[model samples]
Target: MKRVAILGGGPAGAFAAEQLASAGWQAVLFDEKLAWEKPCGGGLTYKAYSHYPFLLENSTPKRFVTETVLAAPRAGAVSLQLDQPLLIYSRFDLNRLLLDRAERAGAQIEQARVLEITRQGSRWRVLTNHGSADADFCIVATGARNPLREVGTQLTACDTMSALGYYVPGEQSMIDIQFLPRLEGYIWIFPRCSHLSVGICGKGEPAGALRKRLEQYMTEREIPWKHGSFYSHLLPSLHTASWRRNRVTGEGWLAVGDAAGLVDPITGEGLYYAIRSADLAVRALLSEVTGLAEKMNLYQRLLRRDFAGDLEFGSRLARRVFHGRFLWASVPARMVQFTRSSPRFSAIMRDLFAGRQSYLDLRQRLLKNLNGSLYEMWMSLGFRRLVPRKAA
Candidate 1:
């Protein structure tokens, strides 16, 4: 049996551990915290529902009215009410379930921080706070801003985008996505069980001012609330140019999940990619049966074929939306409504949302309707003498 080493006991690492263990491979997982609490928007988009059907059974899954309320400094506001519902749950509970499932699948997990990694001949050695470990293969799910900074990995730095959110009694259940012109990012409001999660994020140095501005926005809008005392942690905003350098599959090393820059950019969602990449990595390693290097090669190829388009498209979309006031203003709501109104558009949305098709599939559709899209986007942007910024 091949020995697999998984770094970080988050969703990505745990998923990989589970997949490998179920396939009879020995899997070991390590993380800094035995019980880590992730401070995310806590809203799981429908896009993730297909992969995590059991998310609704988490006992704390909060029922939020499935409507997207969008606001922008430029184009005012627009709301989207969908027949499909969206749900939110505590990140703490969600992660625990996955960890439990992985343990049940027979994967050994160690709550220790990995300090260093070295390669020797056909094996990789990982040094942790507790001790050292050797494995036939290594999976890096250390996330975007991991401090290890191993040489040869394609690393990128991102500006700090601040967010502070929490839940309080009598909070309304609505998913509000707000964009600020002064701030480079947006704020999100997601309902979680009895409490609500609300926070703001954006690029640039105005984050402190942005937070206060958000507080003011909430108060002015008469959104009844209190500023939760616990400060929200910083979320690393980066995606490496390349997930793997010399080779994805080396003598005995592989990269998966955020370490590989596989998160969805637009939604800031990484769980689905983490789980999907883990599944692919384990599947490939299992098929190898002997030559571990060959397994990594297959895993890399599969990930490229299956996810390259979405990753690229999402990055492009993220850049465009954040860099300008057009798309997030009123364009997104208008475009989504316009696209979903037609049967053809509905099918396309289904395929894309279901992950059955790549972003390339939607690209062609968008291109075919580029003229209409541009016109709608222009109208939504106010059509009042402002020029759309050139695409990056």
Candidate 2:
């Protein structure tokens, strides 16, 4: 069996390990912080459940959210019912579950941090705290701070974000989002199995500022957030200029998840993208083709075909929705009204939330809803005019 070495025990690495190991490959997964609690919302979309059904199996501690409340600056809030429920899990629970699946599928778990990965001929050498190992292929799923410069990948600060939040006790039946004033990120209350994962994320914002904003939001919402465990972490966000040239695959290796910067810039939602990319990578790695170059090319093609546009489009939409001029902004409120009024509009949002919608057609979806809304307004006006004449 061909051997593969994967660095990182997050969704991407673990999922890849599971797929490769189940297919009879010797897959070894490495991570120093295996099953550590990450400061993430841990929401899984519809596609995640459908594509990987096993995620919801075996009594995973998760909460189902059916409603999402969107709050725009000074425009109040609007609630949209999700056609499909979202699954929210604690990061630790979710990571542990995937790692366990990988191990069960025959992937060896190594609790060591990979220090370097260098290609030697057809195989790659991985140096970890435990020891050095050689594999036919290497997967750099070690997140945005990956040290594999040989893989030709870099995550700049401009394209990254800093997120901070608290884990507090709460009853979570729905998800809540409050748009930041012209910022690239928002404050969110995501209900996990036992508590609430509330946080504020902003690109280029200092930690102190984000903390102050979180405190203010906590106060306004009356969440009783005092004495909760606080967390801060760095996450990758898509940048138009650099994301297009992200070198994800090379001679004897491939990068998945945050290592390749496969993150949604707008929402900072990466769980879906992470697993999906890993799935594609594993599929490509398992192909019977003989050439490593061909396999890497296929991997890049898969990413471009499947999700490049979505990430770019998400970045654009994020800027439009979260721009600080929202107190008098029509776009944000118009979107909320569209969601409130149009079933098609609501369905698209639901699809997006469900991970069934693509960014390729997001514009078309919005335009179609806008046209329908206008026609309804015109018809309503005509009927009112006719009613006045009949009364007269």
Top candidate (lDDT): 2
For 12-118, candidate 2 gives per-residue lDDT tens digits of: 99999999999999999999899979788888887888888887666978888999998776567879899888899899999999999999999999999898887
Instruction: Give all candidate RMSDs, comma-separated.
Output: 6.5, 4.0
* Residue pairs in candidate 1 whose N, alpha carbon or C atoms collide under 3 angstroms: 167-196, 185-202
TM-score of 1: 0.79
Query: What does the lDDT read for residue 221 in candidate 2?
Result: 86
Put down candidate 1 lDDT per residue, 1-392, tens digits, no spaces. Answer: 46878887777788888878887889999988854657676565565665666665555445746666666554455555545566666677767877888899999989999998888777779999999999877888776555556621344445224456554444665677776654546777777676667777665445567668667877777656574533465543443343323223445666676666666655556677777877788788778455665676788788877774567555556655565433444444443444433344444444443455555566677668667656664565563347666779
Tell me the number of clashing residue pairs for each predicted model: 2, 3
- In the predicted model 2, the residue pairs found to clash are 181-324, 182-323, 182-324
